[model samples]
Target: MEVDEEENNDSISEEEEDSDREPNPKHCFITNLPDQLLLLILSFLPILDAINTSFLSTRWRYLWTLTTNLDFDQRLIVSPTEDFSKSRRLFASFVDRALLLHEGSEINRLRIWFNYDHELYESHLSSWIRFAILRNVKELDLQLEREWEDNDFYFWDMPFLFNPSVFIRDSVRVLKLCLPGLDPTPDMRFGSITTLHLKQIGLTERTIPDLLNFCPHLENLVLDHVGLYMAPLKIYSVKLKTLSIVNSIQMNGSVEIDAPNLLSFTCIRYLADDYLIKDVSSLVEAVIIFSLSNAFFQNWRKIVNALTHVRSLKVQSWWWMQHLQQTGEYSEEILPHKFRYLELETVLSKMELPGIARILRISPNLETMVLESDMVDQMVYMADNNASEESYTGDYLEKVFTGSPLYLKKLKITSFLATDNEIELVKYLLKYGVALEKIILVPYKTGLVSVSPEHLAERFQELQAFPRSSKDAEILLL
Candidate 1:
């Protein structure tokens, strides 16, 4: 009878069979692959996609639960049109069930990004964090967005403090919390975390030091868009290596930093009336970019003095020259330490010529010089109608020109427009750069337009005709 059935099946044409028939597992190469390989392939997919593999077959149903990474987002699971209550219930249920079903003993990373009322899900979030801690999660990232009650904004403190188990974990090495209230208790200790990143949070003087004390082993700290309340914010840590304060709003006072082991300090648009830095002797590099001119005069000298040990400095202070002229702070006594490499982010106009020359005179050992044009600064400089349009006249050039040989070997001009001031700056450098060997000119580009080829050719020829202090000097226009 089996032979008769087999013979009948063989006799039927290929098109006569059901087209929607499920293929045999043995014939499906993907399904037949080793479970380890299949799980590895699933690891690259999003959490939802990885979980959807359970519907494929019984083998894959339990495999996804063993994955090391469980990244859950409420936005990815809940439909916007659904009822708020229903959506919240579904998301909560999904996270709870997923964590319960996870069979892995150790999770590499656990990320939960939820946008809901903290009061409603506080217990649930605490449970999830505890689960992560129990599983020895290495990288724990929690980004919770608090929902306002009546169109009013309020900071929701980290709710896991109720259960000290989550805060006392030693498995988490990298911790990232965004838009959460982070007020660590005096007894809490995050001793294992090496990198701590807090974004869009509010911090006070006490909380800042408390965080540093709690995370004793923290090496890299980043405060992005954080609002500081207390004046004269002081940050002191012995083990901190890299500190980045990006766009942090500080109140009326200054910032005092004392990190003896610090290696790199990056400040971008961080405004403070003054900076009092001490014992940063190990700092190798410092990048300070100020988009506002309010605090440059009061803060620049202190920052520069602290960065005397740095081999490289990248600064964007468009108003330094004007401030120096008004305050008479452009002498070697102000910036006594020299840097090996200097990168200035400013428009090569007469407004910045004196500052540039002063910096050059101080950094007599500078081997590389970069002149970069920051579009925002350029726009601000141009919009000020009261700003004097001082020409690059003989008197102006003569005042800045130090009759000394320059140690600059390589010069780079970015966003070059061949303006009269820009050309004069290039000529001034060429005239004094006795050790100059190479100069690279990058034309300014706007949308689809760039410096015309004919214009570039004319400028290149003109530059070649100018006098050179270095006989082996070469120019490149790109």
Candidate 2:
């Protein structure tokens, strides 16, 4: 009995000893991951986040140094209380340090954003450009936000300008600059840049021609809120494929876009249209945004005339119908054209359906139609005030849908206030939409109580019981 008891005691001691032994290290195989796989994983992380991973373990400390893409954003480093000058200096030092730590390594991309004082801006700009050129950088994006004083004070001595023509190296293939104001000096050149984006820059006729001359091999160009000083500005680019211009003010100067190889074009609030629409056979898509002004309407017509071969057309405007009515060009004159997709927004019920119908008539091949607005209450109120005018419910829907082309397969109504008339409109579409594939109803704040899919299904079934011919329609409520 004593021997058996001793044996049991020995077994328990051995079990406890085994339990006390440590398991294999959790990340024993992490170090074995291939360097290429690790680098690829780190590439997706933002530069700061990737740097922070260095402290996770000793192996990760030097791993970040191997990353070829370095992105430094000063907004991340600046605090409200930090002196702007000191903050700029510290940021510059950090960037220099990071570069030194990764010396002799090739950098794929470099992005820096800073708001600097006038004294530091030029030197820091030179350093960044020099570093990018030395590393044979493929992409360089520098955004300099000028610090503004109180509402009355000016921001800087000179509107912080960096002439890409003079500062950029031939090795850079992609370059983006967003400055408050820039006057490209005559000596500036960007001969080797393939892609370029200029934002909020003052580009006159002479300056634009000079800039274009520098980028002989440029392919893609984006100009946003850029001022054109030259009237009748003629742009001639042979290698350019894509052109995007947004919120640009025209100098009553005619602007021409003459890129033969240009495949895609987008213009928003650009006044002059001389260059784009003139015999652009290769254009596949054209998007135009107009303001509710007489000048824009005249330009809109010219733009429409220019887009003879456009496969996709999107027009967005506030109070478009009122503008058209004010111009006295009714829907019967405009609704015979064809487009693949159509999106229109207006103050609902205030605009005439015939005018909407006129716009729709032009898009015979339109497969999808999206009607968005926040004016249901205004429509209801207007109908109440003018009882003689038809309500914007069943009558309006019947008129528009009945006249609309059957090619429209999808209809999306967003930010809609569902009223009795509006529900009847949806039912009418479901009943008459013979080629319709889907109908989506999105509720806004007002209108009928909560909506659901079951309610939509029941409504659809009730409409079908009366035997309208739209056999394959699907109704969705959200």
Candidate 3:
């Protein structure tokens, strides 16, 4: 009877154990997905992650092979346990294997970005380029950053070249090549590309003009750090809407542009040179930050007059000539007088005040104004004259106030030393500007003028109480 009871108890225990175990579901949601959808899902992932999905299940084994877009960026790899050398080797091996096993006949886009290595990865990189070109990639973005611990250019003598002629497919729309190697055939052309971005490209005289002659559909062009062996480079494009030249050195000749449909023009990190834009009446914005040269002095007025149609403008001059010659004294209607926003940065000496006054006087429609500069001459002028701040500004401020229509809605001054001259100028603007909305004073910490915070508070009170044309104008002492 005890043996019978033990068998019955064991049977009950087995039944409870069987009930506790849950049955596994037959279908996984991801594996059940359509092949096209799965392939698309794999395309969004990095190649490494895409390949790793093969380990998930049989359905995802070869899903990555159908991926038409390949973007290999080494910077994406991050692992705390693994060192970079190991990660780099694994990254290279995976990309190499994936491309070798890729099933797509044509690539939609192929982008590769990595620091250039000459000894080890040169052939690998070249093979990858050839693979993409052979597969008829429509968009190719190849950016090779030259890793340099010292100052010399690492790629100045490397022989592994990137010839744009390899891109023969008419389906190509956008092509960006960094450190683009040179030597082009006379008749070679990119018939379908609409956007071309070239960086660190050593361009000869015939290269740009010849290239632009064939690329008529190209509307946007950016030349950054381009080593232009030819001076006075002529960039003539009818369809170009946006053109920017930055950190590019041109030795002798002045740049001449004739883009009729251009809507924006920007030149920065370059010294002032003659940039003649004739037919850009549609331009709405312009940014000019140029180093000053003697040639710039002669062409300053012409350059300003050319960009007259732009409504927004920003200008900074590192060097200013004490005496300037006017090639042609243009009337207010002819100059760029339609500026709604203007920012000027300079060394605010007494002499540079006229330049500020000149822009203020001409821009009758200007609504916002920003001024930033170190005040040198204004302080010296007051010290040398031994006159009060009000007396010193009585001449310069009154001239600008009377000569120019006072419609400014906002004003900002940087390096606000709270000196008598500076205060007098602010007072003059507050008193004259009838439609002024706001005035900002950024008290620069030059330590040259020592005004206590209490004194600043008193000045703020005085400015708030000291009446002017615009009663609603607020002052911010920041």
Candidate 4:
């Protein structure tokens, strides 16, 4: 006499149920799905909406709680009427409750991103970190942005002191912390950390030792806008394969790298007194970008000499090229004479011809050259207000123009404006490169903005008509 509960729940009277319900025939297709597949479908939905699935039927009542990933993004919770403070508290409460009831015993990944909050949400944030630690979370990402007010003053809603001891479980292999004011303890360690990223943090005397001891297996490291408080910063890691150091402020500390296995290194706008690079024989690629006027030639030379084994190099030294002229620091003898691929970012000007020619001369076996003018910087060039024309010295035409290049074959010129100076540079390379095989000219406005058909045609026509020494050479225009 008792109706089956499962059948009773599935059966709704046609008169009582809304017409919006799924077609009657298709009802059980979803409810009959396996639990594992159902959990995955819930994982893609927001936590709030995922939890609402329990209302569908008895089968999905606790399925959402079994999700191994937790992503709490504030943008999903904010309402038009709520202020920043109210929104912060509401998000905090929702997250705390979700974690407390979350059925997963071993969380695989946890991510939290929220709008800047003030003093009210610190404890909640701390609890979240503790929860991740207790659950042995594998991947954790915490992004805390600063909240700026009318006065342009901002406050970072983050715990300045993060004791690495809490994360000593060594379960976290990949971690990214982007807090502007994070300060670490000297004895902190991330035992199993392999890939680590720290942004807008302070590096003091204890910074290097604290990290090296804690993260022994660290291989990939990226430090961006790190404030250096010490004089000499020494980084020695034998297992490190990749490193990136970028600066938002002038670096007060000189860095010395002793990573023997390092394969790639990138430095941008970093000012150090002197760098001591040793045993980095595994290095194959390097990118160095500097505003030459603000850099010391001697300091720049020391950095270049260390890259003796690099096969691929890209340098952005627009202002530095002019610095060589103004400071009389020109040198054709410093760098090694071995390079397979060399890409340079500079404008084609008479003043830069000597430095460029000197560079080409050193690479006796250079095969490919890429010249990009989109990276042109006129900072130092525009500052030379008292400059009088020197009648365009540095006869690239008579010297590099007439000489026979042994290995130079392929050339690609991007952001080409078809200027007289640029054309002259092409002519110089064409006449000298007896082995030249191909030429590609991409107009300055190629992909950046719209270019008139006439202008684009002119850029291609000018370069194609330029004479080449190799009779079998082919030219392509883009």
Candidate that scores best on lDDT: 1
C-alpha local distance difference test of each model: 0.75, 0.63, 0.66, 0.68
lDDT of 1: 0.75
Give the least accurate 10-residue stretch of model 2, judged by summed lDDT.
Answer: 1-10
TM-score, predicted candidate 2 vs. hidden true structure: 0.77
| lDDT (10s digit) by residue, model 1, range 245-346 | 998778777888999999989998887777889889889888887764544756776786667778888886465665565775576655534678778888
Give the per-residue lDDT of model 4 (tens digit) for 1-478. 1222332233322232332344344557987889888878877776766765665655656677898778877667545367766667666766777787787777777888776453666677778888998888888878765564565322222346444455566789878777665656644678788887876666766676568777889998888766665456778999899888876333466778899999988887676777778778899888776655544666666777788788878775454455565656545446645777878777666656656666776787778888877332543444464333342365533554455464578888887766676777777777677788887888766454555768767756776787777886777777
Candidate 3 per-residue C-alpha lDDT over 1-478 given as tens digits, one digit per residue, 9 for 90 to 100: 1112233233223233333333234437767788878877776876666755654555555667778888877666334255545545544554566588788888888887766554566677778877887888888888876654566442323454444456666777888777544434554577887877777666667767877876768888887767654456788888888888887766555678788888888887544345665678778888776544445544655666788778888775223222312322224643478889888765554445545555666678999988776346434433564534232144644555464448889989887656554565567668778898899988777777666888778877878787788887889999
Candidate number with the higher TM-score (3 or 4): 4
The best candidate by TM-score is 2
RMSD of 1: 8.8
By descending lDDT, how would the candidates be arranged? 1, 4, 3, 2
Using TM-score as the yardstick, the better of models 1 and 2 is: 2
Q: Where does candidate 4 stray beyond 4 Å?
A: 1-109, 134-136, 147-164, 248-252, 319-330, 374-376, 379-381, 384-397, 434-440, 445-451, 467-474
Better of 1 and 4 by lDDT: 1
TM-score of 4: 0.76
Residue 342 shift from truth in candidate 3, angstroms: 1.9
TM-score of each: 0.76, 0.77, 0.67, 0.76
